[model samples]
Target: METLFWLEDSIVGMTVSSTQWGYPIVLSLHAIGMGTLVGVALMLTIRVLGFAPAIPVTSMAPYWRVALGGFFLNLLSGSALFCGNASELFFNWAFRIKIVLVLVGLALTWWLVQICVKRSDQISPAHRILAALAMVTWLSAIIFGRLIGYWS
Candidate 1:
């Protein structure tokens, strides 16, 4: 656990010490990636929950894959963005809340993927509830994260 945090710290350190434009560029991409991941995830989850019963559930799974790719891209971008301001992020109250919310959002998504998707062998009706919750939580997380930049 400590090693993982250390790795994150190292990445953040590199970005922080890099040129100013580098930070902004990575941050922009991170925001874009977040939008892609969250948007697609919400859409797919909603489809699973029966909101879009006309849509094939398995076909919708592919969108989640696309979302996973965006998530990885965001991981890279987020690393650079954080690396550019490691110390500040570590100290920011809003940033901390944002991180916690992100964790919760991820956990909820994972839970839905396993319980609703795996058990049903397709998206379950329960997915609608999970999707709605995910949207709210993820949107709040992103908004709070953006707010940190503005306030700081």
Candidate 2:
């Protein structure tokens, strides 16, 4: 494997020399996106869990939209950050683990969305169970993402 570290020196140079504060700006958005992604995801899951019947299931669609928005925000920011620290990330085992978790979480989230749409007419219990699982997957992904930085 190439290790994808071919540009480490250049990436490090750019990352460390951001007079325009691009890194901080991207990081800030990434953080905000993460908060929205995890927060809204959990809230919707709880709604599906029946915390608020006032919230029509269709309302959750907006949250799903926000979730997608978060996904793009994080995708861009995370990719740039990753490119900027390829060497460090490549060596960080915790980061590797976090990446795997995130992949699984995203796949599960997509599946959850599909199921929710198809079973819109299904009763609450089954919906609640799947939503609960989605919540767990998202929560675990976020926790592991944090652990990557802390542990590495």
Candidate 3:
């Protein structure tokens, strides 16, 4: 408790929490990061699932760059947000769930990337299943992220 309060009182935390536009600006970046992360993820997953047969799966590979950019952006912005409300967020169930989901989702995405890097012409059942799971995990993270605001 004392630690959280201390963290919340830190310079970065105070700026995010007390400044008129600081929180909103960080939040907007977070939202854009989420959109970039999930949007690129869905594009790759759907392509793997054969949504657009004309576009080769290898072509979709480059989009992972955008996803990674979004992930790092979110990491920075989310940390700032967490600092601003450390005690409340740390104790929030929804925040906990969101963190877990995001971790799992990122792990699954890494696995999917490994599979893609192999560049197999044939899409295995395992590859399809992994892609599907990644999509679901990311979407669930988004849902729980929103729930954190409402439930916390």
Clashes of each: 5, 0, 0
Q: Which scores higher on TM-score, 1 or 2?
A: 2
lDDT for each residue of candidate 2 in 17-130, tens digit (9 for 90 to 100): 343686787788889878877776777677777777765665466567788788888887777777666767777877787677667666766666666644473435777787
Model 3 is weakest, by summed lDDT over 10 consecutive residues, at 114-123
Q: What TM-score does model 2 achieve against the real structure?
A: 0.79
> What is the C-alpha local distance difference test score of each model?
0.71, 0.70, 0.87
Give the per-residue lDDT digits (tens) of candidate 3, residues 2-107: 9999989998799899999989999999999999988888877777776877776777667788999999999999999999999999999999999999999989
Candidate 3's C-alpha runs over 4 A off are none
Instruction: Please give the ranking of all candidate structures by lDDT, highest first, separated by commas.
Output: 3, 1, 2
* Model 2 CA lDDT for position 5: 57
Candidate 2: lDDT over CA atoms? 0.70
Index of the highest-lDDT prediction = 3
Q: Model 1 over residues 1-152: C-alpha lDDT tens digits? A: 45445645684656545567766777778878888888876775666556767765555555667777778888788766666666666678888888888778877877776666555555544666787787788888888987887665
- List where candidate 1 sits over 4 angstroms from the true fold: 1-20, 118-126
